[model samples]
Each structure stands twice: as C-alpha cells, then as structure tokens.
Target chain A: MVAGRAGGEVMVRSPGRFTEISQDECLELMATTTVGWLAFVDAEGQQLLPVNFVLHGQDVYFRTMSGSAISSLADGHDDVAFAVDHHDDIYQKGWDVMARGTTARVDDPDLVAQVAAGARPRPWAPGERDVLIVLRPSVISGRRVRRQ
Target chain B: MVAGRAGGEVMVRSPGRFTEISQDECLELMATTTVGWLAFVDAEGQQLLPVNFVLHGQDVYFRTMSGSAISSLADGHDDVAFAVDHHDDIYQKGWDVMARGTTARVDDPDLVAQVAAGARPRPWAPGERDVLIVLRPSVISGRRVRRQ
Candidate 1:
C-alpha cells in the first residue's frame, strides 16, 4: 500500500484497494453531486452525455432542450443509466456510483407545479431547456478505491 | 455570466454558454485525463462505467479484470462511447468530450510489447487487469461553457 497527497485529499491505500460503498452513501453522493453523465442509445451506438441533475427524494430530475439528442432519444423510453464518479488519479484512488432506472417526461401539470415550487436543477448550458425528465432509479451500485 | 471558485480551477461563462474545442485540444485532454466513463449497451440497457484509459494516437486503451463487465462487453463489440467532462459547479461552468468507437482486445503480442515500453494507463482499481481493450474512435465531439 502507498500513501500520497492528491489535490487536497490525503490518500492512503490498503492491500485490497477497492471498497463497495453503501446504499446510504450512494444516495448521499447523488444528492450532493451537481454533475453526472446520462447514457442512452442512439443510432450510431450508445451515447453518454453530461448533465446537471438535482435529486428529489430517490428520483433524479434534469432539463434538456426539447429537440436535443437526449430529449429525442429519451422519448417513450424507460431504460437509462446515470453515472457519477470522482477520481484522484495522482494517488490512484477514486469511486464510481451508477444508477439504472426508467425515465418519463414531467408532463403532468400538477407534478410540474410541485417541482417548480421546490429546489430545481438549473441548467448550466445556455438556452431554454423546457423538457424536464425524471429518472426513478431501480438499482444503485457503487465502488470506491480509497486509502483505508 | 457568473464567476466563482471550484476545486481551485478558475471559471468563466459566456452568454451563449457553450464553446466548441479543437481536435488537437480534445486529444491532448484525453491523453492527460486518466479517468473517464465508458458507455455500452447490454441486456439491462445502456450502461456507463468508469475506467482509467490511456490515449494511443486516435485510440483509447484500458485494462480490466478478466471477468469484469467491461471485458465481457468488449469481447466482440465495436460500438462504445467514452466520455470525459469537467465542471466547476460553483460557477455553473463545464465542458464535455465524447468519442464513439469500436473496442477489441489487444491480443497482438508484438503490439503489447510496444505498449509495455511506453506510457500506459495504470488501473486505479485493485485486481490483475490482464484484459487489455482498445477503443478506436470514429467520431469525436466536444463542447465547453466559458465566459466571453
């Protein structure tokens, strides 16, 4: 096992190296992290695009342009994968949390009104992102490599 | 446009919010960044898993454990999406680079010998990463959000 400085994180390693994070930790990280990648299928192949998301309970919500690639592909599809990971490459440590779920457009006026009244994920990209999609995660998995 | 601090990186924003990066810059960033998420399709649907990768010209290469999901998926497939993006959530700024390509096991003994002598992406995960997979990118696209 090696020890070193990575960014501001003090990293220590154990012989085993990687640990599986708990469900609670996975949900906590998902709520706190602002950026993640959303993977969906496209004509050419599997497409993964970065998105800014907000956690509402156990569901993930994000906005995209109505005609954007994500919006188009996500239409009428339920299966989606969202992944968030952080790395300290200098110290050879990191963690990845992945969630798989079904997605649907937030079209119900009542539900839209409810979300509008609460915290929302503001789009970082410029433009009017009117299409709101919500992902209800069915399974969550995580693995971490940290100094033990 | 808003400006702020995030993980010691200076952030700026533009009115339109997103900027396109050049091919050379994309390749350079790909080479320097050690961690990225690889997206592929499986029975469950689209999957995005993080992997440590090294850039070899236009191709991206990584090693995974023999029984790992990545190794199993890349066994006989070509279409895969590898994405690397960075963000300063404090300032609501970031960029994403995506590459679409095919993956194949690097079984050529002579080529493996050549790569062994050069800079390789050391896996951060614990395990004997004997299965070497290489992704030959066919399409590359990038977008960044920066202050004007």
Candidate 2:
C-alpha cells in the first residue's frame, strides 16, 4: 500500500498487480499512438472525447473544428487530461499513460506552419478541423498491468 | 454550426462529419463493452483511468482495490465522467459513448451479493478488488464517426 497527501487530501494506493513505467517509457508510448482520449470540464460538467493526437516534443497536439467541444479547450479553460492505452482482452494485458496539464490554442503562424508541415495529426472524423489545440502536460505517468 | 448556451456560457459546435447517436444507442453500446475510461478530479488534478465495468440498469458498476485511485471516487468526490469508444484505424469508423455523473460505494450486502452473482465486471488486473463503486449518470451522450 502507498499513502501520501496531495493538497492536504490523503491519497492511498492499494496493492495491485501492476507496475509503474518510467517517464521516458510514457513519452515513447505517447509518441507511438495516434489516438487518445481528452478529458476536460465544461459548463455542463466533465466531458471525455477521443481525438487523434501527435506528440511534438513533450506537448500533445490535436486538431478540432472551430466550435467543436474540443476546440473549446483553448478558450481559457485550460485544465485538462489526456490518456492513451492499449488493451488485449484475450490476453488480459495492457498499459496506460495519462498526462494532466493545461491547453492553449496554437495560433502562431510560424509554429502552426511547422506543425502542419511535419507529422501533423489527421482527424478521423471528416470536415474542416482547422483549429489546433496543444496540451502541455505538467505531469505524465503510466502503468502496465501484469499477467495474472 | 450549432451554437447554444450551457450554464450561461456560449457553446458552439462547428460542422463536422459525425452524427449524434440516440440515448438508447449509447446505452446499448455501453452495455456491450466491459472496459471504459473513468475521469475525475483529485487533489493532484484531473485524472483518467481505464476500468472494467458492467451496466446495471442505467447505472455503471466497477470494482477496485481499497485505497486505489478509483476507490477514492466514493469518498465524497463524486463528480466524475466515464467514456467508452471503439475505433478502427483501417476502416476509419467508430463510435463513442460518454456518461457524466456521481459515484457511490456499494456497501449493501444483498446488493453486493447479487452483483457478484450476476454479470459482474471482472477486472483484468489481478487483485482482490472488493470495493464496488457505482456511477449514476445524470447525462449520457454519444457520437458516431463516419468513414472518410
């Protein structure tokens, strides 16, 4: 069991058959994946959506329609989380990587041009997704589930 | 474009090549999947974790080891969100279901016994996960991404 305190709140983690992966491994995993889930809070409440993402350095980037739910992430409501995981149901093995951070709109012409020119994320859902949002993670962590 | 007010905040959704699925369809899709991601806020910040869940009526239930990150959901930090999605990279088609709600611990012996005896969710990770947490969603929504 692991016990700690976060912002005066007690946090405990019970024993489980899983091991934490290093930050390097987490970044590698994030780089290899093209899709991930983005979680954020809106006026209604919390929302989670799957988005195609690309890793540029340590920041995660994805494109969205100008007024879509995800595009709202760049409107000053920056607290957000992103997660990527691969699970094999038959073998019951998988790994998960999660990053928590703030988001901002990628509006710099030079930076946007560079991102659009090199290894840019392609949205699966069609239509013009011209707005780019970048999530600069403050913390990144991961865990790998062990075989039973 | 779709524009509306959410809690006095302007919410906009630009044109996208995706269609919203009905509530019934969302419920059905959720019932078919055993694994979903749960998003919540803790002292550290926003967190997202994959969990194996079972649908009970309109509620979702999952087990966690005591003191685990998920078990903390029942500790009065009830504002949470759950999401399940299936994506086909080759086909470029998929669907997503999201539920936003509150969580409560299942302590009733009879209900616990019944859940354990029924279509209870079996965690892929090895552990004695005895604590059951139920998410009662106040809103559920979904969308289907069309093939490009």
lDDT of 2 at A35: 77
Model 1, C-alpha of A34: deviation from truth (Å): 1.1
lDDT of 1: 0.71
DockQ of all candidate complexes: 0.22, 0.24
Per-residue lDDT for A1-148 in model 1, tens only? 2333333222222253778899889988777677889988766458788887777777777766667887763475667899898776566677889998888777766555555445444456776556668888899989887543
Model 1 CAPRI rating: incorrect
Give the per-residue lDDT of model 1 (tens digit) for B1-148: 2333333221223254788888888887777677889988866567788887778778887767677789875576777899898877566677789998888888776555444444344445665556668898888888887533
Please tell me the TM-score of chain A for candidate 1: 0.78
For model 2, state the Cα shift of residue A112 in Å: 1.0
Each candidate's root-mean-square deviation in Å? 8.3, 7.6
lDDT of 2 by residue, A1-148 (tens): 2333333222223333788999999999888767799988787567788988878888987877787889888775557999998877677678999998889887776566555554433555666556777899989999998456
